[model samples]
Target: MGHGWRTLRRKILTPNVSATYLETRGFRRKDRESQELLEKVGALFLAGYAHAVEASSIADVEARLGTIEHRFRGFAYEGAGMGYGMLDGLPFGHRHHNDDFLAGPAADQIYIVYCGIGWAMARLPRFRWPKAESLDPLLRWLVLDGYGFHQAYFHTRRYVHEHYQAPRFPWPDDESRAYANRAIDQGIGRALWFVGCTDVAEVARLVRTYPAARHGDLWAGVGLASTYACGASRDELVRLTELAGEHRPQLAQGSAFAAEARVKAGLWIPETDSATKILCGQDAETAARISVEMRPEHVRNGALPSYELWRQRIAEELMSLGGVSK
Candidate 1:
């Protein structure tokens, strides 16, 4: 059984460079039911992809993508397994083996993976949604080869990407097509809001505005409140968005709607990595903020660092070899 588990791990860890091979691999499930569920969702993804391909125009493809989005949203928000409602509601942010931390009923990890995929897929063809048929291969790739990758990615990559490279858009971008792609590549407008840089007064105001019991989606609010952290006036905020459109085309196109979504939700706004850097060097406030904001008590209390911790651990190791302490 140990050897079998090792084999399973190997298969999962193997690189998935080929789309064809990805189409045929079986899932690693502890039960018959999970295997069946996997198959069902895989079919749904494929059908949606095919529909997007068959659609007549960009609008039609978007409509089909909308159907896929709606279905995935149902899975994300309402499905019995691994939905956003279930994951976001956990108070402690701790995953229990008996409680479905990485797998099983509370598939928060998987649901997040799917949501990220859906978000990106619907915005292909250089961040433009692809024709329906072109999407099939991508969907198939996701279900077969991409599943484990996403599982690991959410646990680790999501934070860095969110902070360093990724931004969630509530809807489509408005910029000219050419500019949007480059901006995303250069890492514009992607920062997680709650990483401890917020002013205490602001935190207090927000907590008072939202009772602790309802702060489960607090990160969403962080994005909305960001410019305030920068002390940007309303006009400045609008100017920043315009600057993003003019200079960082990718960010302007893709993130405007997402920023608006956060704004509408009464959430705080995103503070870029540069803003974070301002808070990171030589001050107690910066250290405290990094410790508290990027990692809360639940995360800091763990025996093993989460995925992000491990990455940092490796960097620390290399730094030590170079006789530098970061």
Candidate 2:
């Protein structure tokens, strides 16, 4: 999938490659409406790109941007769209993970990156998932909600193990890097909590229970319960509550901040800082160092997956091929 994604990125980003791929695939030219719509979406993404960050602090928005891309990729798998482009580097109306905004940049890049995820979503009928209908609101919700923190989180293997880990994928040793960790395990667990905290279900239920609690308490109540059920310790749960506060601001920091706090303050015994770094787009080596330093026991015990070597190899290949650039 990664290799295929790299190919897709090059094909989409390089006009010559794009033409060649289209020719090889016998693809037709996209109509003007499609092109114009793509442009409009790009404009929207650019407009919100700076403020798109949910966290108050950014060492590099690009790092957090990688987190958003990671989260959006997970969202793509779970029968929904994050309303962004493919994280595999296929640009479409999608905002770059980096903070610097260049002037007079090509809008095509923005649209392609931002809308790349939507493009993938459009291909989902072949995968037995429902087609996305007008992803505008969905995408807005995703970025605004801090890249669906809970959704990205639910895809982790630990969540699945806590729920249905036995006899399934990602055995104890492979738990951290299992394929299922990023999709089924993490997505479902996080979705439940995220939905529980918002009025999503209530709003859906409101169609039946008109004049009922308008997505406020009901969502938060369910989110709280889901958080607890997902093995969050009492202190951790309180911390989540504190971050959420009263209004539960539609921002991303609560989750990122909480993750940082848990590890730094020794609140929750995390899987590894490397795993968290992966969420933030750190290369494998950096992630490993952070992980080992943060949790020596996990590293010595072989609890953390050793993907750094493979990641490095892939990164080298990507750099050689110009599939990735600084």
Model 1, residue 84: C-alpha shift (Å)? 26
lDDT, candidate 1, equals: 0.28
Instruction: Name the runs in model 2 displaced over 4 angstroms.
Output: 1-179, 182-184, 198-326
Query: What is the TM-score (0 to 1) of candidate 2?
Result: 0.24
TM-score of 1: 0.22
Q: Please report, in order, the local distance difference test score of every candidate based on alpha carbons.
A: 0.28, 0.28
Tell me the number of clashing residue pairs for each predicted model: 24, 28
lDDT digits (tens) for residues 1-326 of candidate 2: 25455345434432232222222322222444323332332233332232222223223323434443321221111111122222222333334322122111212122122222423332333242112222222121122122222322323233212333324432122333232222222223233443222223321232123122222222232232232123333344334433433323211111222233233322332422322222223333343333234331222112233322222333344234331233
lDDT at 40, model 2: 33
Q: Which number leads on TM-score?
A: 2
Against the true structure, what is every candidate's RMSD?
A: 22.0, 19.0
